[model samples]
Target: MVKVATYFAMTFGAFLFWQSMDRVHVWIALHQDEKKERMEREQEIKRMQAELMAQAKESES
Candidate 1:
């Protein structure tokens, strides 16, 4: 009975450890995705700014 109890405890510990790692992995994935989206938004903003500048220059000339 003691050995069975020990085995159960070790298995539970391992399960908890694996679950924590899974959470970490999910968080990292979400962070990376957000970073990628932010970069894309920045690029769009830059493109829009350039277009506006060009329009202004044309109007001045």
Candidate 2:
């Protein structure tokens, strides 16, 4: 009886650990996606600024 109880406890602990790891993996993936989007947005903003500067220079000339 003691052995069976120990086995059950270990199985439950493993299941909990697996679920926590899955959550961590998902969180990491989401964080990476957000970072990628932020970088893309920054690049777009920089591009627009450069284009505007070029247009202003053309008007001045």
Candidate 3:
């Protein structure tokens, strides 16, 4: 009876640990995706600014 109870407790602990690790992995992946999106947005904004500057220079000429 004692062995059975010990096994049950260990199994429950392992299950909880696995669940928490899964959440951590998901959170890391989401942050990485967000970072990638932010970089792309910054690049796009820079490109637009360059285009606007070119237009202004052309208008000055």
Which residue pairs clash in candidate 3? Answer: none
User: How well is each residue in 1-61 modelled by candidate 1, as lDDT tens digits?
Assistant: 9999999999999999999999999999999999999999999999999999999999999
Question: Candidate 1: what lDDT?
Answer: 1.00
Worst 10 residues of 1 by lDDT: 1-10
The segments of candidate 1 whose C-alpha lies over 4 angstroms from its true place after superposition are none
lDDT of model 2, residue 14: 100
Which stretch of 10 consecutive residues in model 2 shows the poorest summed lDDT?
A: 1-10
Alpha-carbon TM-score of each model against the true structure: 0.91, 0.96, 0.89
Runs in model 3 deviating more than 4 A are none
Error of 2 at 28 (Å): 0.6
lDDT of 2 by residue, 1-61 (tens): 9999999999999999999999999999999999999999999999999999999999999
**Considering TM-score, where higher is better, how would the candidates rank from best to worst?**
2, 1, 3
Backbone collision count in every prediction? 0, 0, 0
Cα lDDT, model 3, residue 40: 100
